[model samples]
Target: MTPQPGSYPGLTRRTLLVSAVAAAGTAFAGNGSATAAPALALRSGSNTLNADFAWARKRALDWVQTGKPGTIPSYWAGLTNRPAFYSRDVAHQMLGAHLLGLDAENISMLKVFATSATERRRWYPLWAFQFDGGIYRTDYKSDDNFVREVPAVFELTEKGVRQYLWTGNRAYVDDAALWKYYTNSVTYFIGAHDDNRNGVADEDGTGKIFQGVASYNENGEGLLEAGDGIASQYQALLAYSIAQQARGDEAGAQASARKAANLRAHFEKNWWSASANRYIRGFTKAGARTNFGKENSWFLPMKGLTAPGPRTDAYLDFVHKSVSDLPPFNIEAYTYLPETFFRWGRVDQAWKWFRYVADSRAAYPEVSYTTIGNIAEGLLGIEPNAPASALSTVPQLPSAVPWLELDHVPLGAHDLAVRHDGNKTSALTHHAGPRPLAWTAQFAGRYESVLVNGQRQPAKVSVVEGRTLSSVTITVAPGAKATAAV
Candidate 1:
C-alpha cells in the first residue's frame, strides 16, 4: 500500500497513547473462526442494476488494476510523470481487488500474471519483487540504481497470490520461482516486520497491528509517524488467508486470517465513528482522523465480502453526507476528500489538521480530475465509458467517450442507450419534471456535446461526455424543487 505525500498531521501524546492501547487490545478482538473462501458472483444483468452499475464497475476496475496481474500503462505515466507501461504495483492492486468479486475480467487479468509469459517478460522480477514487499509512494529514476537496495517485500503481494490460484491456470502452478515469491509475500504480510535490525524480519512485538513501517509525508501536516489504511490491508488479508489454506501453511494462514478478520475491529475502534457509522482515514498517533480520502473506509461492507449489519446503514449515511448534494466531479470516493479539505472545513475543525488538506486543496482548483487506470490493465482496472455490466457481451472495448441514443428511450433516463465508439445524437423530449434551464457538462476531453430535453441545450453547458453527462450525473432545474433524474 502506498502512503500519501499528501501530508496530514502527527499524533499528540494522548493520541499516541490511544493508538498504543487500541492496537494492544485489538490483538484479541476478532472471532477466531476461519474465514470462508471468497467467490465471485455470477454475471447478473446489463448496465441497469438498481445500484449504479457504472459506479461499481469503476471501483472494481481500480481494485483489480491496482492489485495483481494487469499492467496499467496510465497510472505508471500519471503517477511517476513518465511514459505509461505495465508495472508490478498496478497488477497486485488489481489482483487483490477482484479476489472476492470473482469478476471475470479481474480473474482474467490475474491469470495474465500467473499464466502468461507476456507479463513475465515485461515486468517480472520487479513486478514479483514489488508484489511481496516494496514501498512506491513516489516514482524512481532509472539512473538511480539505489532504488534496488532498499526495495522491501509487501504482505499485500503475498496475500494476492492466494486469490491468483483461484484462476486455475495450471501454467501458473508450474512456475516454481513465481510460486515461491507469492508464498513468501504472504508469510511477510502475516508475520512481524524486521525494521528493528532483528536477524529475521520478525520485529512486531510492540503489539502494534501488522509490524509497523516507519514513514514520513514530507508535505505532511504533523511529523512522520505510523502507517494506516483498510482498503489495501483487507485486500491483502483476503489474498493471504486463502494462500495459506492452499499452501497447507494452516498456522501461518490462520494467523493472517485472524489479522484480516480483526481489521474491521481495528478500523471500527480506531477509525470508526460509533456516532456516525462512518469509517475515517487511518489514525496517526494523533486522535484526528479525516472522514474522506482516495479510498472508502467502507470497502469491507460495500463489496459485501463480509456482512455489515447496522454499520452498513450508518456508513451509507456517512457517504451521503460526505458527497456533495450536487457533485461537481464524478470522482470515485477516494479522490474526493482532498478537494473538500482544501475547500470546506468540516465540523469542529474536525479535518483541519489531517494529512494533505492544504496541499490537495491548493493544488487542484479551476480544474478537477479523473484518474482511471487503463482500458486493458486487468488489475488496477479501468472503466469503458458508461459500460454495460459485462464486457463479454459488448462487441467493442469500452472507451472514454460516450454515444447516446435518446430518441428511442421514450422519456426514461435509465433507458438511454449509449455506446463507446462513434458519434450518436438523438433528441429526448421529457414527459414531465423540470428540465435544467441552465447547466454544464463537467469534463473536458472526455465529451464534446449533449442535448437536453430536445431544444438542444444552449451552448452554455460546457461539453464533456460528447453526448451524455460525465460519469452519470444527476441534473436539477435552476431554482426548481424537482431534480432532473437520470
Candidate 2:
C-alpha cells in the first residue's frame, strides 16, 4: 500500500538521503579512508554542571566511518580488521544510525543484511558476515552450532520496517523483493527454529542459548538459554505482525500478533523467578535454572515484555541493585538499561548511568552510538513516529538537570530543535521541511494545565505502566515554534 502524500512529516527521501550520502562521501573520500563527521551542537548543562556532548557526537560519527564495503556495506563490529558483520551488533548500530539522522549509512547497513539472507533457505546468516568480492559467508557449522541464528534475521526484518517508519520511504516499503525476503525469513524462523511450537524459539538443546554464539554475550558459559533469545523472538514476531499489516496481509498480521502474545504469556509463566525477585536468565537442558543473577534477565523489562505493577517494579529494582556490580563500560547491558530506567521513572539512576558511559567515551560503536541514542531518545524522549506525521517528546530530564538543548534533530522531513528549562518547561522550535509537523509533549507528573505556543491546549492524562503521563498535541506549519508548559 502506498502511503498518502504528507502521511509522514518533515523530510523527503531524496533530500535526506542525498544530503546524508554526500556528507558520508566527503567524510570518507578515497579508498576506505576514514574521517569523523563534525559533532552535532547538542548542549546540556545546569547551574552546577555541564556535559561535553561534542565528544560523544564525534565518537559516534567516527564509529560510522568504520563501515567497510563488501556484499553490502556495514559498520564493523569494532575497529579490528576482522571484516565481519555480527547481526546483533549491526542491528543496534543501525538503530543508532537512524537516531543520528545518518540515513544513508543506516540504509546501507540495513540493505546488507536485507540482501544477505541465505539463498533459498530464507534465513539470515548465523552471526558474522565474511566479505568476498560480492559474496557473503555465514558462520554456521553443523557440529559446533545447534541453535539457529534467529536474532540476526529477526532484527534485520524488524529494523528494515523501522527504517521505513522513520524515513517514510514508501519505495522501500513497497519493494517486492524485500517483502518476499522478509516474509520468507519470518516464516522460516517460525517453522524451523520454534521447535517447541510455543511461539518462542528453543535452543538446539546443545547448551545455553548463547552456546551457539547467538547473543551479545558470546563468551559466557552455562545454560544461558531463553532470556535474550525469547525476548528477541517476541519482539521479532510483533515487528513482523506490524510489517504484515502494513503490507495489507491481514491474516498474516493477525497470526503473527497472536503468536507474539502467546510467546509473551509463555515467557511470563516460565521465566519469572519468584525467589530471585527477577526473571531467571535461562534454563539448563536438565531443567535447572542458570545465570539467575545475569543482566540478561533485565532485558524483559527493557523489551516491555513484563507488565507494569509490583512484579515489574521488583524487576526494575533488581536491575537497579545490580548496576553497582556491573563492570564498567559494559555496552551490552548499558544499551537498554538507561532507557528502561527512564521509562520506569528512575530518572536519576538513568542519568547516572548515561553520565558514566558518556564520561568513559568508550570506543566501541555500540557504546558510543547507543549512548547518544539514550540521550536523545531516552533522556530527551524525542520519539519520531514518521508514519503518523507526529512525534512524541517525553523528556525524563533528571531533577538536577536544569536545562538541556538538542539542535537539528532530524524528524522525517523536518529538523527539530528542543530546549527544556526548569523541570517542566520546554520550547520546541521546528525548522519546517516540506510538510507540517504535529507534536505531542508528554510530561511525567499530573499537571493543572498544558500550554502550547502560550495557549492552553486540552491535555490528556493517562497511566502507562504505573506512571502518570500527561500529553498535549499541537500542529505547526513550516518555520514555526511551539512552547509547551506543564
Candidate 3:
C-alpha cells in the first residue's frame, strides 16, 4: 500500500527537503496538487519579533555614522567577512512599519530601541508628525530633521512616526528627508543589472530606471539580486502608506506606487523562479539564481502593498503549505545535500533527505537562534506583528527526556516519532536559580537536549520541537558540570 502523505503527520528530515524544494517552485504559481500540502497548521504560540529574524532585517537597515546605533546589530556575527549590512535597513524599516499596522504605539517604542544613539535630535524626534510641515501640519523646525544611515532615513519614516505617536517630539516623524531619499534607496541595486545605481523604470513616479552595481560582498563577488531585498522592503511599507493615504499624501503615495511598479518589473525581469513555479531570489547574469528561504516569504509577496491580490495570494499559499509544516519556520537557507530542487524528476530522493531532517527536529528540539524565534512564531506575516515578541524569552527544549512534557496540546508540527520509557521519568521542571529550565533525570535511557540557560543541574535538557539525540542508553554518564547550560 502506498504510504499516505499527511496521515503519519510527522516531520521527517526528508519531508523538510521535499517541502523546501517544492516551495521554491510554487513560490510563484501554487502547486496544483493540494493533497501534498496541508491547507492549515496548528497555530502554535509564536512571535514575529524574532531575535535572529529581527537581526537579519536589521542587518539590512541598521546603520550609524558613529557606529553605536542600537536598533539593528552593530555588526553581523557569523560571517567571517561582514557585508556592509546590505539591504537589511529597508527590510527592517518596512518590517517595522508592517508591525505598526498592528499596533500604532510600536512606533514610539523605537525611540527606546536605538540605545546606541542617544541623539534623539538627530533621529526622528517623536513630536514631529503633529508639528511637521505635512500630515498634521505642525510648525516645528523642519530644516534639521535629518536622520543617520541611508536606509534608516529612507524607510524608517514610519518607525519615526510611530515612535513619535506619544512623545510629541516633532523630530521623530521627520518625513522631509524620507521623501528625498526614497529613490536612491531602491535605485541602488548594484551588480547584475547595471553599471549605474538603478536599472529599468517601473510604471510609477518618474520614469526612473534603477541602477546599482552587482557588488554583493566587499570582496567584489557579483551576485543575483535585482535589489529584491531592498525593493521588497521599500515597496512593502511604501505601498502600504501610499495605499492607505490614497488621496492624502498624493505625491509621496504616487512615488511609492511607482516604486512598487519598479519592484514588480524587477521581479518579472530578474527574479522569477521557473523551476519552482514561483518567485525565488534574483539571479546572476550567468543564469544562476538564489533560493528563497525564510526571508523569501516576506521578500516576494511584500510587493503586493498588503492588499488582496497576486502577492497576497502567493503569500497565503506559502503560509498554508510548505513553510507552515517545515522547520525553522522556513526552508533551510540552502541545502548542503544533493539535487535539492523540489520539482526535479528525482524529487522523491530529495524529499527523502528533507523528511529525514524534519523528523529529527520533531523528535529532538531546536537550539539555534533563528528557528526558535522567527519560524515557530507563525510570523510569516499572517497576523501582522500583534504578538511579535512572545518568544523573546522562549525556553529551550530538552535533549534527553524520559517523558515528553506535553501539556495542553502539542503545539508543534507532527514530524518526528518520539519513543521512550515514560515511567522512568520522575520530576521535570524549569531550573530557575541561575538557569531557566533544568530537568532532574531520575533514570536515563536515551534522549536529546537543548541548553536553555547557562546552567548544569542533576539532569535536564532544553530543545525545540522535532529534535532528539538517538536514544542514549546512558546507565550513567558523567554528572553534568555546572558549566553546562540547561
Give the higher-TM-score candidate: 2 or 3.
2
Cα lDDT computed for each candidate against the true fold? 0.28, 0.59, 0.27
Badly placed stretches (over 4 Å) of model 3 are 1-172, 175-183, 186-221, 230-248, 273-276, 288-298, 302-486
Question: Model 2 over residues 164-183: C-alpha lDDT tens digits?
Answer: 55555543455665676667
lDDT of 3 by residue, 247-269 (tens): 23446544554555564554555
Q: Backbone clashes in each candidate structure, one number apiece?
A: 47, 5, 95
**RMSD in angstroms, candidate 1?**
18.6
| Ranked by lDDT, top first | 2, 1, 3
RMSD of 3: 19.0
Comparing 1 and 3 on lDDT, the stronger one? 1
* Better by lDDT, candidate 3 or 2: 2
Candidate numbers, best TM-score first, in rank order: 2, 1, 3
Residue pairs in collision within model 2: 10-413, 10-414, 11-412, 11-413, 11-414
Q: Per-prediction TM-score, please? A: 0.38, 0.82, 0.32
Q: lDDT per residue, candidate 1, 1-486, as tens digits?
A: 211111001111122222223323222122111113222121112232212223333443333334445343122212323222222333423322332233233333333333322222222122221221232323332322112100123322432342232232322223465455455443432343334322122222222212222211112332111222233444455444444444445576556656555653454465555554455543444554545422333333332222234654455445445543434432223332432221111211212211222223321110111111111111111111110111000111212123312111111011111222222222122222222311122221233333444323322222211111221222433232211111
By TM-score, who's the top model here?
2
Error of 3 at 204 (Å): 25
